[model samples]
Target: MFNCNWGFMTGFGPGGGMGGFGFLFNLFIFGLLIFLAYKLIQRLSRPDGTRDREDSLEILKRKYANGEITTEEFSRMREILRS
Candidate 1:
């Protein structure tokens, strides 16, 4: 014969004894945490906020310095960006 503490088990365990909302509430909280975690990870992975406006300007200057782009093209693009 198993000496089962049914009262305590039902009260704390997954016996749906602490009202039906307990398990559903815990599940909703868990899902919310997962959603927030996913959004945080996505936000951290992108370079949008991490990069500044000057980054592109610096890169364009480097390309001009390296002779990858002509001076006219560089000046035109730089003026366009500055405006």
Candidate 2:
């Protein structure tokens, strides 16, 4: 004789509750997916070495503005960067 009870199938059987662990597991997976997507987007937004070159130029400008480099040195580096 087959038992007709289906409570276990619905997590309603004796000692069947997951005690909220299932919700936590799903939340963790969702957060991991979101983090991975953000990282992928950030990585794809930069094209080739342009971003690095621009960043270097910006740093160079900052150094010149802060008086960390002489006019001749700044002009020399600026010319080097343009090439």
Candidate 3:
């Protein structure tokens, strides 16, 4: 007869079903999936050129408000940005 008590044969083995590293492997895969999903959602939320233009305009406005740029310079840049 075959040896049924061999650890690999049945679920009653020393480390149980999946062995020691199984939990860690599953956890890693779960984390990877979550990270990919988050990145996909972030990418899908923004339109291509629109997000960049908006971000650039916001930065320009902040700089003007902070007095880092002259009013003439701000106006010029704002006009350029709007065009």
Candidate 4:
């Protein structure tokens, strides 16, 4: 005689015998994934200089050293950045 698995098929199904805990667990996992993605997007959207810790003063120095700006312009820009 073949018997039907009503206990595992009818109300609860095969997602473990726990009543509604399986659904709750899946929901928790989905929420955690969303939270992680939001955090990742926020981090990626930020400017690279903030992450690299490059300051405006350092950039001005590099520009002056590269001869991209005159000495007077470099000093003025450096003063502006320091303020």
Candidate 5:
């Protein structure tokens, strides 16, 4: 015999009745999301970001060897990369 009071039935319709427990649960979930995001970012960013640079340099070196770049350009690019 549950009489539904349509007035404030959902406590705040469409929003659901999360109340105190709801708020705490949401906060916990939000905190977990933030922590996970931080961890993911930390893992993605590293001093070994040099790998990408080296890979690009390798491509450039190959292009030079294939006679795609001028000698002067190759020397300049090599010097720039070494630094």
Candidate 6:
């Protein structure tokens, strides 16, 4: 049996902090990629707000037709459009 004495450790490791720094750098790059993906999806989902607004109106109309909104409620909401 051999006794090994490569004792305690910090996250940054013995006299060299680069491993921890590299971990953080990779994490940052990963987060940036995720953010860019989200933005790309958002951009692809709705290239223009006007079309999105029209789609929302169609959904609202469907909801109204399905009696999700009562006549009075629909009338009141007609004065205020949502985006």
Please state the error at residue 30 of candidate 4 in Å: 0.4
Error of 2 at 64 (Å): 1.3
Tens digit of per-residue lDDT, candidate 6, span 1-83: 98554322222345544577755765677799999999999889965676867777787788899999998877666656662
Worst 10 residues of 4 by lDDT: 6-15
Residue runs of model 6 more than 4 Å from their true location after superposition:
1-17, 47-83
Best by TM-score: 2
lDDT by residue for model 2 over 1-83, one digit each (tens)?
A: 99675533434334546635645655677799999999999999977788888889999999999999999999999898877
Instruction: Single out the weakest 10-residue window by summed lDDT for candidate 5.
Output: 5-14
Worst 10 residues of 2 by lDDT: 5-14
Superposed by TM-score, candidate 6 places the C-alpha of residue 67 at a distance from the truth, in angstroms, of: 39
Of candidates 3 and 1, the better by lDDT:
3
Which residue pairs collide, candidate 3? none
How much does candidate 5 score in TM-score? 0.42
lDDT of each: 0.76, 0.78, 0.78, 0.73, 0.77, 0.69
Candidate 5: tens digits of C-alpha lDDT, residues 1-83: 98775532343334658666656666677799999999999878866658877987998899999999999998898888878
Candidate 2 residue pairs that clash: none
RMSD per candidate (Å) reads: 10.5, 7.0, 7.0, 10.2, 10.2, 11.5
Clashes of each: 0, 0, 0, 0, 0, 0
Reference-based lDDT, residue 46, model 4:
94
Best-fitting candidate, scored by lDDT: 3
TM-score of each: 0.42, 0.57, 0.53, 0.42, 0.42, 0.39
Between prediction 2 and prediction 5, the one with superior lDDT is 2
Please provide, for model 4 over 23-50, each residue's C-alpha lDDT reduced to its tens digit, 9 standing for 90 to 100: 5766677799999999999999997666
Clashing pairs in 5: none
CA shift of 36, model 4, Å: 0.6
List the candidate 3 regions with Cα displacement exceeding 4 Å: 1-18, 65-68
What is the C-alpha lDDT profile of model 3 across 4-65, one tens digit per residue? 56433333346556765655665677799999999999999977788778889999999999
